[model samples]
Target: MITSRLMVLRRAVCVSWLSSCVRKQNYCSSAKKTRVREALTSLDSGSSIRIQGWVRSVRLQKNNLFLHVSDGSSLHPLQVVASSDLNTRGLTFGCAVDITGSLEKSPSHKQRVELQAQKIEVVGECNPVDFPFKIKGHHSLEYIRQFPHLRCRTNVFSSLLRIRSEATAAIHNFFRDNDFVQIHTPVITSNDCEGAGELFQVEPAGNEHSLDEENPHFFSVPSYLTVSGQLHLEVMAGAFPAVYTFGPTFRAENSQSRRHLAEFYMVEAEISFIQSLEELMKVMEELFKASTEHLLSHCAEDVELFHKYNSPAHREQVNLMLKRSFNVISYTEAIEILNHSSEQFTFKPEWGCDLQTEHEKFLVKHCGNVPVFVTDYPYDLKPFYARDNEDQPRHTAAAVDLLVPSVGELCGGSLREERLELLKTRLARTGLDSTYAWYLQLREFGSVPHGGFGMGFERYLQCVLGVDNIKDTIPFARFSHSCPL
Candidate 1:
């Protein structure tokens, strides 16, 4: 009887709270809150609306106060006109304001509509002196990158972020449309996807230097951050015909260059029943064209800003890439072209040596400045899992790399060795047979010829937007000696 009475009292209290909320919501609906982007495009004139945003610019005319405000809804800001008396000392650039106004057609030729403010409230104030960004200042990418916390307030970084978000969704949709399964690969792993040994080992905060002393090594053995999710995706490919993983991949690379980051995102996909590199290249080409097309169609204004301001030549390059089919050449042919070219290279291209950035850029230019697939790399240059071509004098693996004009080596992939005997011999030669015992077991159980490719998400953004620095493509950069929150 006591429990039933308490339940009735709780129901009455909930009803009272909901009724109060509904009353407040209906009252606030008088000046319907609207985003700048929605208001600019959809809302009709002569509608009462409320807008909240930071001040981008403040103009004082003879009798009127004009302020341009943005809520990061779009690249353009909404123009607000008010009486000069409404302007106060607290109203400054970078200051936040809540505005209730009537939308009206503008007399000026610049914009189609403008906001006529009836009341303005200064919700947040900015001194403008302490702010890293200046109003109407043209800051370079490097200059704005210093203030990571406040960089999104700038025009360039903000647009890049919006484009990045759209590109991410587009890639996922591309996979889903093609019947590919998405897998969430782990950040912590017992295996090194790449045997380069540049891994960021993880452990408890206090036991940084405990390296195999007596703590049982945390995970029983040393575990490190994954440099690539390809191996994990390969495991999923055994269960599903097509699978992909997109997530942050960490490496201990000590690079501060425009194209390298210690922590970056990768889009990796694996497909079963593919015996040739051509099948893999087809998917790579389709993904590039599809994702780029999506960005151009959906985020035209944001993408155009980069093409117009950053790289004027890239617009034509991108159009040509979409129109023409990508070029393909063997690794041996690429080396010959490099050796014969008159252009001086820092790292000389050789048949067995890995292709450097300079070499990759030259290859793309040699192939009419379009994306070129360089296939059949030397056996020694590839990782242990690459399928052996088994050619006589010149040994090579069935590996391929897709190199782009601006961004070299956009994607890398190979046909994985599915034969148990061949894989076992290769792993044993490298003294990693015991380490990869489970990987070898996959071949023994049931395996079909499969191939996959990994594309660097940052590099893809850099290519599409003509961004010179890879750091500018990602929201937060993690490089050597630097990790800003």
Candidate 2:
């Protein structure tokens, strides 16, 4: 009987040990939890929750300590309140911390709810002196640009990231909804799409000296970082009725203007069986309107931050852009408007010359600061692939450029030269017939009159946000004589 009692005691001890282990495991699992965004939205009062994020601000009061924490989910940070009795060690601006707290109604009007902390654990410590962002009132976009690595921690850059992500999603959705297949185009190519002589040559590693030797270069013939994806989209359009590509493009031009970037993104779309420039312009207009609408609806708060801090004029521009349809005018009419303008232009408006930024800005203003599509540019000003208009007085191409306020040209597109004879003749004149034989084959097999356009992604952001520089729109700014990480 005594031995039986002892066995029962041992079994009871084993059960207790197992229960203890389970409790510890549960505690450990629940410790590293809760996003600041979710914590801010909690409606259950007096519920214990754990939140983790980088501390945006810390305010110590006589009885309580308040911290503004953010996990990048929203533009605004969550308010975390801890009692003076709680350990506040290692909690500072930019320091990552995990706090176990209770949900409570906020006394202040800034936020709906705040965290009443019972425990605070420092996940990572940051030195306030070494941190570049010291929680200032308002930082200029130019000043924050100096610290690319840590700029995302700020409110403005973080908002831009959110806007960019939403805009990308909206672009994909617009294409998908309209039955346009997203095609991945090759970044390296043998022919320059623009034929501008601004190609960045790509050579094989350890063979830098053999560029001119002609001893089996990296690609047999020379290859370059693609300046545009229009040709590839053109190729795909032949197969698929509608195709588009959004990817990085490179240029070797030494332009240092606010609107220029050596490496940037382009959104190109090609539609087969297109008859006139009107059809292509319709697609471009719909795309711009749809994407901008999506951004304004979804990222209203984040986009407003750009207007409030960056440029107050941006608010009116955005409202106008949304309220009205884009304006359309012929290239000839645009030039005439510029020529008739009272304001003196640095580059005089001429018949055959390319429209400079000054001219584009003037045209946009003349149209009451609305986005304008100027169609039928001079044939000589466009590339060899642009379809010839074959007009009476002036030779022009079936090309169009979308110009916006603040930014000169946001998009450029043309109806492709699909006639085999016309394409061959143009290529022969440009001396690119042999190099672009494959392009000719597409016309030979199944020729359909098609057109496409390329929109500079950075310039689009600048136009929508009224940002002054193209660099501020992109995550990493790359330009002439400047490449910073």
Best by lDDT: 1
lDDT per residue, candidate 1, 84-116, as tens digits?
Answer: 877466999999888877778778767666778
| Model 2 segments more than 4 A misplaced | 1-43, 207-214
Worst 10-residue stretch by lDDT in candidate 2? Answer: 1-10
Q: Residue by residue across 129-171, what tens digits does model 2's lDDT show?
A: 8898887657788988898888888889988998998899999
Best by TM-score: 1
Question: What lDDT does the true structure give each of the candidates?
Answer: 0.83, 0.82
- Each model's total of backbone clashes: 0, 0
Clashing pairs in 1: none
TM-score of each: 0.90, 0.89
Error of 1 at 477 (Å): 1.3
